[model samples]
Target: MRRYETIFIASPTLTDEQAEELVKHFEGIIAEQNGELLKTEKWGRKKLAYEVQKFSEGYYTLFDMNAGPTLIAELERRFRNHDSVIKYMSVRMDEQTKAAERQKVRYEREGRRKAQAGIKERSLEEVMG
Candidate 1:
């Protein structure tokens, strides 16, 4: 298996739930093809650098995984068949970068958990102060 990263832009018109579902759908495809998903990040709605399908904004999602060549081809094929997907790109990840990514994900998850716990234990003013 080779490490790879995929970034896909979906139509901005989709609701939050719809967007989540769309991301999950592609993630499922990767898993079904024996791909191991390392991480998934939702960048939320952002202004596009240029117009695509006449839209100025889009939902951006990133997926990091280890997959085979055939799996990558099928993933791209599905992206082309999905109308809501405005654009998608996939690139192979280097070994050193993949190691760094693993560390980054561990730190991010620990930070998020701490933040959530803090939110439940302190007021906004107390936390900020």
Candidate 2:
């Protein structure tokens, strides 16, 4: 599995209940595909940089997940088929980026452990003493 980020814009005309249903629809897809959804952020109704589908604003939703390529393809296909979806994008995060994130967590964890253990780096004289 690889980490992926997807941001999609839905038609602003949708009612709150309709919008929630749309969000749940996609979330269900991820679950059905055996993918893990890391995060879902709804940035409701923002002005578009430019008009799309003759609409000046859209309801934005972002998804972060760990999934295989097939899930991404399926999600994109579904997005394209849905009339309410005005725009969508999916990007796969590189392993280097993932590794760096893990490395940062590992470093912080080690630092906390060292602090708890009362272990600190010392100069040669301090070590000898």
Query: Which has the greatest lDDT?
Result: 2
Q: Candidate 1 on 1-129: residue-level lDDT in tens?
A: 898999999999999999999999999999899999999999999999999999999999999999998999999999999999999999988777878999999988887998988844467999799
Q: Give the worst 10-residue stretch by lDDT in candidate 2.
A: 90-99
Tens-digit lDDT track of model 2 for 46-112:
9999999999999999999999999999999999999999999999886769889999999999989
Q: What is the TM-score of each candidate against the true structure?
A: 0.73, 0.74
Candidate 1 lDDT score at position 75: 97
Q: Assess the local accuracy of residue 24 in candidate 1 as a C-alpha lDDT between 0 and 100.
A: 93
Each candidate structure's count of clashing pairs:
0, 0
For residue 111, model 2's alpha carbon misses the true position, in angstroms, by 23
lDDT of 2: 0.94
**Candidate 1 Cα errors over 4 Å, as ranges:** 95-129
Considering every candidate listed, which one attains the maximal TM-score?
2
Please give the distance, in angstroms, between residue 41's alpha carbon in candidate 1 and its true position after superposition. Answer: 0.4
State the C-alpha lDDT per candidate.
Answer: 0.94, 0.94
